[model samples]
Target: MYSKFIINKDSFLGLAMNDIDKSSGNSLTTKYKNIVDSVLKEKFENNKYIDGSKIQSEWFPQVKCDIFLSHSHKDVKKAKQFAGWLKNKFGLEVFIDYNIWGNINDLLQNIDDTYCYDKLKGTYSYKKRNFTTSHVHMMLINALADMMDRTECLMFFETPNSIDLKKMTHSTESLTESPWIYNELFLSKILQNIQRRKKNELVKSQESVRLYADLNENFNPKYNVDISHLIDLSNDDLKNWLFHYKDNKHQNKPHSLDVLYNLKNINLK
Candidate 1:
């Protein structure tokens, strides 16, 4: 039995069998290899390049979620309240770190606290194998990447501290130097661009192709200015963007209550 299989444009079914064959007996490997080869040859002989756009469309034909709430660890309470409001009012599925990480945050907090204390006490030694810095960092990156992958729409919960830090910073470091919130924003923008590209490719028209090309010319994955401007918006304006009502005729009216009422009435499964 094949333990893992991943089909990509470059490798196809051969790569999957090769990967499994590395750890399997010759006879067992031969059995699965022949099966996979035969299946691929029979079913997918004409399909050379994997249709990434088609696969993406079939998997997420519509918006899988209403929002992905990205916020600082310090603002967990407020974020939770906002998430609860969105869910109760709009029946929207909001993805927050707490929902995904659960008790892992507590564990990581303890580990981080211990690490800091040890460093301050001059007892932190790299020779010790107790949750090294690299391990913890890798765990965080992997978890955040997974969560971000599942998010259909991303909303950053900006606070005073986040705004100040973002404004004060001016480096391109990916590690301890850059704030995690900023990294999350960068990653989200990159993911958004990728999804946009996939969706655009699915249009299958010369006009769409030209439009996509033009869009790419202006697409900056860094999104520094855009994010800063968004952070500077008032609560109502921010809410408008989140609810996608910026161009509505009632844009001048107060948005909070009205938006909530509208969402509450819209029946969403």
Candidate 2:
């Protein structure tokens, strides 16, 4: 099962993790890009009907992670800093979408230029681009959901960039301008909270679930987000968790996050 945490603005500020993070990020991004590129090339090698559904599994394969950081595109730098801080302080692997899937735009552009372009008119076909984008976005949404399901914790970096203060008149109601953020938050609220399986336990694979049937090329709908269920953690709460972690640093590094769960008495499994 996943535990959701909302990190308020200015909760923590520190230098990002050093070259280690940079190097690892570069390696992972390059590897992912290569894999995606190869998969696309292999699919197009023949003119036979291409099954986009089958390729979704090959694109953006899931990776083991400790925390999933969901934030606005504008807050990417802050998310990176927070991720680095988490890595340095707790040895946690933070999954920031851009870091791993930054080449999404490149992939879209490539598809549009190759299949959606009208060479005679020197322009891209709107309908063709729409079809390509829908498929790419669907694949990304599925991959993201899988990652969220696998991670132990999901943290949303809440700030003005991600949350619309004007619409938040009541404690229960929240709004966001981002469709991606809306989808992520919506999934967090509904996705089943499965208990973390032990190392030796055999995992069960379930059928893929698609919840965004209304998504489209012009996906600009306003979202009334429900974040009341997410546990609110301020700077002090993070500091308290950090203090507890340091006090018993000798515990297993991988399961160090259990300290925060125990502190909040939340069943994260």
Candidate 3:
């Protein structure tokens, strides 16, 4: 019953129509559908096709960052400084919530005001303000989710204001002042696990192919000639190859924390 959209490289154009599960009524799917519809209306007005195929568009949910820095509102200044350092030191784009939401303070203030006024007796305007605030929060959450998916990795800034060291040491789940940061951390971990699972599956498939090639039906000299090179490869060499293959497949990506630490120490060229 859990509905989700699985987008692959092949069928990008049919994204909107492909996953229309009416019974689930998932808001995330609806948001994606709306975005795709808007893009199609603006970009492909003439219904243009390239090489008898639908052209892939990459404008719906814009993601131009290699890393997403999830930090508390109190750490905006530090986040900005770190983002600048990353950009100059490694030529990497960093996405910070502060940049997206110009003034978090003001936004939070408005939400507080909406909540306070909503509790007033028979306030007609309270309903409208509450709806507006809810809509804005939903949009922000959806945007963050999309950015997490697109970014290579998510680096969480664990500051004193955000996390309580005492609680962290004693309890399994440490409470944070900023709930959004915790949400981002959970989503990022899930994404990483999913990616790792996919890579493992790909490795298993490759191993299966190698095994099949080794056990050939026809042992004739002509048939065995081509697979002779494969036969000579040792188990260690095959493992090394698979390791390299996975690295190559992922384009030698660095861990988020590792990249952050390297950026902090290295001098900008």
Highest lDDT: give the candidate number: 2
lDDT minimum window of 10 residues, candidate 3: 203-212
Candidate 3 residue-wise lDDT, 97-191, digit = tens: 55434443355345445443545574436455556455445444554565556665455555565554444344445555444655555555444
For model 2, the superposed segments whose C-alpha errors exceed 4 Å read 13-62, 166-168, 197-220, 249-254
Deviation in angstroms for 69 in model 3?
0.4
lDDT of each: 0.40, 0.68, 0.41
Q: Candidate 1 versus the native: TM-score?
A: 0.42
lDDT string, candidate 1, 1-269, tens digits: 00001111221112122322222323322342344334323322243432333322222222243455666666655555555555443445555554433343344345445544466565544343244344444444444554455544456655543334343356432221224555555555445322321243322211100001112355533223236322222444334434554345563754333343353342221
- Scored against the true structure, residue 104 in model 3 reaches a CA lDDT of 34
Please report the candidate that would top TM-score against the real structure.
2
CA RMSD (A), model 2: 4.3
Clashing pairs in 3: none
| Count of clashing residue pairs in every prediction | 0, 2, 0
Q: Who is ahead in lDDT, 1 or 2?
A: 2
